[model samples]
Target: MKPTGTLPLRAGLGLKPEHYQNALDAAEKAAGGGLWFEVHPENYMIDGGPRLAWLDAIAERYPLSLHGVGLSLGGPEKPDEAHLARLKKLVDRYNPASVSEHVAWSRLGSTYFADLLPPPPTRQTLQTLGDHIARTQDYLGRQILVENPALYLSLQGDISMVQLYVEAAQMAGAGLLFDLNNIYVCAHNVGGSTQDWLEAVPADQVGEIHLAGYTAQDREGDEVLIDSHGAPISGAVWALYESFITDAGPKPTLIERDENIPPFDELMKEAGQANTIMDSVARDRQYG
Candidate 1:
């Protein structure tokens, strides 16, 4: 297998099926620099199909990141062997700049859940997750990034979630995919400081950053923010993202919108906004 390389420090868009043609055109015009795209590997895990063909055509033009949603690394059992094999195939085929999976679990025995459920951040759970991540890296022959999940309900984890992620990455020799929207949603829902969590992240270990839209609703006589990548990014999330970029420097950032898909131009506009922030930060660092 080819060695995984670092993604360019620029803005990327989540590659949705609807935007395939536009992504390809943009990539071609960009000549494979200054932009990148990420996709859920599960969507293209097929024997033979037009989807894979579309990915092939696009991969030829732009750098790609394989963001896995079904690894279930934090589950009680080991990472599913079959699922890992499928992921390995995709990784080998694409040789993405990065490969990432959620720090949350979504599988129990043979049954799979649609949602990426948060794992209890206990010491024992941490060790299990670390072991699983190590095994996954060994299997793929490359380090994989673990992403923070959006939590809805509280759990009885002994350690703070940030500490859990830090320790997990250190234990497994992996990197982090910092989803800023998730942090905002989690902090608002659970009552904590988003900036504190952002400050706690080890800058050197962050491989990528994600920005997306979220929704707020009243539930049980209180308001909660849901990490729904359906609408445009909120102003508060944008502020948090700018703060993070200014502190951590620029990482390969992504604009994720999985639901309520908009026109390709609109998605690019959001990606462009991210690029503007990144460029402004870079300029400040360069001049100062």
Candidate 2:
């Protein structure tokens, strides 16, 4: 369900287990926190634990965005009922400011994969994706933003990935979680213009933006970019982020670092940088 509570038009960081106490302290220090925090939701799906308790404390002090990684919205199968029930409980418990899922599948029957695999962007796939998203929203009684996947290889399809992404969200009356690092990685790893993605995306549909870092690796004696959330935001992705907000206006941006997690202060530094960019855009809009 679409959350009635809203996040600040500033920056947020993905909350990690290591930084729970620090996040609580930070959230308590600032008013409305100016900064918000996101989580995988899957981590807190279990009942009555220290992790869930920590999240409860943080949610009370600051706005939370539940960025789910499961549910496999891009798959042919409908969302798992058990998963939806747990997610809905979280939604009801926290009343998060925003909720989101990905445009990739990670499950086949009872077996789950470690990676989020992208689906072909054909008409049939689009229909399945849209139906799944709609069903998820219906079950939760709120809308969700669907994130685009980081593609390693271009799949054959009738429509473009961008088209499939935007259309699926529109079909479900949902929002977009635009990930700048993913697109940057896609362009470098596969082939596409980041500008084309920017041009194709509707600014109004974008409820949140994600900024992260990618790593370069050797594969088959060639260079490939991996969407590794281990390092600081790259200059290229940061430039793309600035360009996006400058043109599309500001959205709730997130410094999404998951793997090789850094210190809380370092993540906050990235979030502060996002705020600086948003502030610049706001000032330009007022003065320009």
Most accurate candidate by lDDT: 2
lDDT of 1 by residue, 1-288 (tens): 223438889888899999888888876677446788899999999998899999999888788999999988888999999999999999889888999999899999789997899899899888999999889999999998889888887788788877778789789899998999999899988767787788888888899998999988898888888898999999988998899899778889999999999998898888889889988998999997
Candidate 2 shows a clash count of: 5
Worst 10 residues of 1 by lDDT: 1-10
Question: What CA RMSD would you report for each candidate?
Answer: 1.6, 1.3
Give the per-residue Cα lDDT of candidate 2 at 116. Answer: 86
User: For model 2, which pairs clash?
Assistant: 1-141, 1-142, 1-143, 2-142, 2-143
lDDT of each: 0.88, 0.89
